[model samples]
Target chain A: QQPVQSPQAVILREGEDAVINCSSSKALYSVHWYRQKHGEAPVFLMILLKGGEQKGHDKISASFNEKKQQSSLYLTASQLSYSGTYFCPRRRNLEGSTLGRLYFGRGTQLTVWP
Target chain B: EPEVTQTPSHQVTQMGQEVILRCVPISNHLYFYWYRQILGQKVEFLVSFYNNEISEKSEIFDDQFSVERPDGSNFTLKIRSTKLEDSAMYFCASSRQGYTEAFFGQGTRLTVV
Candidate 1:
């Protein structure tokens, strides 16, 4: 099933923080995050595996709660460049080859203001 | 720093025409995927290919759509009969192995009239 992303849209001021959550109905092995600017391909951010593992890119971090079948992306001290749509993809059993392809969420749009 | 590359950034075709979108995934990647996003809509997965065969495909990937790995460096998505609804930004992605973090290409914008 497609994961559900919270806050269909958000407006943030520079230097603020925001959290985007992706929740799935089924158990998930990992959560992959990506940010896409207008008319551009989505850029990889980080991947959080099961067991509550967390990963990030510099200040953009994410957390995965395996028990809840959910993941959260945290943007700390948000910059203008952070403005984009965020999506999370879920997959089962991060063990072998199947770990690459992901089932994606609809995505959350974030707009940063000066 | 290798990235997925796609050709013909934008294409226009009339209904019933055939359109082929091309992509070259990262050299070391083993899994290839095709996804599409209509303007103002969410990205949807079309199919995933590995070992010269499809590993998985979504319902949206129907008889009208086909994929091929013509050579060592190229993967292609062919739409046999174009419909207005087929207009979208088609993205190609690849991962080092199956079920891993995917890297996407710039995308080919296909406009079917």
Candidate 2:
């Protein structure tokens, strides 16, 4: 099933902080985050796998809570480059699965301005 | 430093015509998939292929669509007959491992007229 992302859109000034959340009903082997700008393909950001796993890049970090089937992305002291749409992709635990395909959320649009 | 590559950044076709979107997945990857996203909708999985065969597909993957690994390096999605609704951005993704960290191509924007 497709995961649901909260806060369809957000606008912030540079140095501001924001959070985007994603929740899924099905179990997930991993949660992947991506950023997409207008008229462009999404770019990979980071992946959260193991339960309680926290992955970060610079000031962008995300947490995956396996028990709750949820994940949250935190943006600290946001920059203008952070302006884009954020999407979460998920898959069920690997185990014996083959050719795993990801289901993505509706996406959250975030804009940062100086 | 490897990444997926897609061809014909944009394609325009008429209704009932055939269209084929091409992709070159990352080298050494074992899984490949095709997905579509309307301008304002979420990305929807169409099919996943491995071992040169389809492993799974969603309901949206009707008989009209087919996928192929015709050579050692290319994967393609073909639609037998196009419809206006088929106009969307098609993405090709590959994962080094079957179930983790997928890399996505820039995507091919298909516009059906």
Candidate 3:
């Protein structure tokens, strides 16, 4: 099943902050975040595999709450390069096996303006 | 850094014609996948290939669609008879293992008119 992402679209000035949320109906084994620029392929951002795991790189960070079946991505002091669609892809445990197939959310379109 | 490479960044074909999109995944990756994204829509997984066989596929990957790894470095997705709806950006990705992060190709934009 596809996960649901909130704030379908957001516009921000450079150096601002934004939060994108993803929620799933099923238990997720991991949540992977990606950023896709216009006319380009999605780029890997970060992956959260454990509950309460908070991973940060530069000004971007994410949190996964397995108990809530939700994950949130945080972008602080956003840069113009951050303008793109943010996607959260997740996998579920299937009969003790990870399907390895990632179902992606609809995506949050973030536009950072100068 | 190694990256997945796709050919013919853009292709325009008449409806009902055959089309094949190619990809060369990272040399050491063990898992390969194909995904598609219609303009302004979410990316959807089409199929996952491993060990020269399909591990899993979505309903979108019907009989008309087939995948092949004919050589050590080439992976291909062939569409027998294309339809206008098949027009989309197709991306190829590969990962070293099932649960790791996958790297995606720049994507082949297929335009079936």
Strongest candidate by DockQ: 2
DockQ of 2: 0.69
Candidate 3: tens digits of C-alpha lDDT, residues A1-114:
878999999999999999999999988778889999998999999989888999999999999998998999999999999999999987653433434677877789999999
Per-residue accuracy of model 3 over B14-101 as CA lDDT, tens digit each? 9999999999999999889999999988889999998889999999999999999999999999999999999999999998888888
On residues A1-114, what C-alpha lDDT tens digit does candidate 1 reach at each position?
778999878999999999998899987777888999999999988877666798877789989898888889999999999999999876654577553556766689999999
lDDT of 2: 0.90
For model 1, the DockQ equals: 0.63
Model 2 misplaced stretches (Cα beyond 4 Å) = none
Better of 1 and 2 by DockQ: 2
User: Which residue pairs does candidate 1 place in steric collision?
Assistant: A97-B98, A98-B99, A99-B99, A99-B100, A100-B98, A100-B99, A100-B100, A101-B99
Model 2 Cα lDDT, one tens digit per residue, A46-109: 9887889998989999999989989999999999999999998777647557858777777899
Worst 10 residues of 1 chain A by lDDT: A92-101
lDDT of 2 by residue, B31-77 (tens): 99999999988788999999899999999999999999999999999
Quote the positional error of residue A56 for candidate 3 in Å: 1.1
Best-first order by lDDT = 3, 2, 1
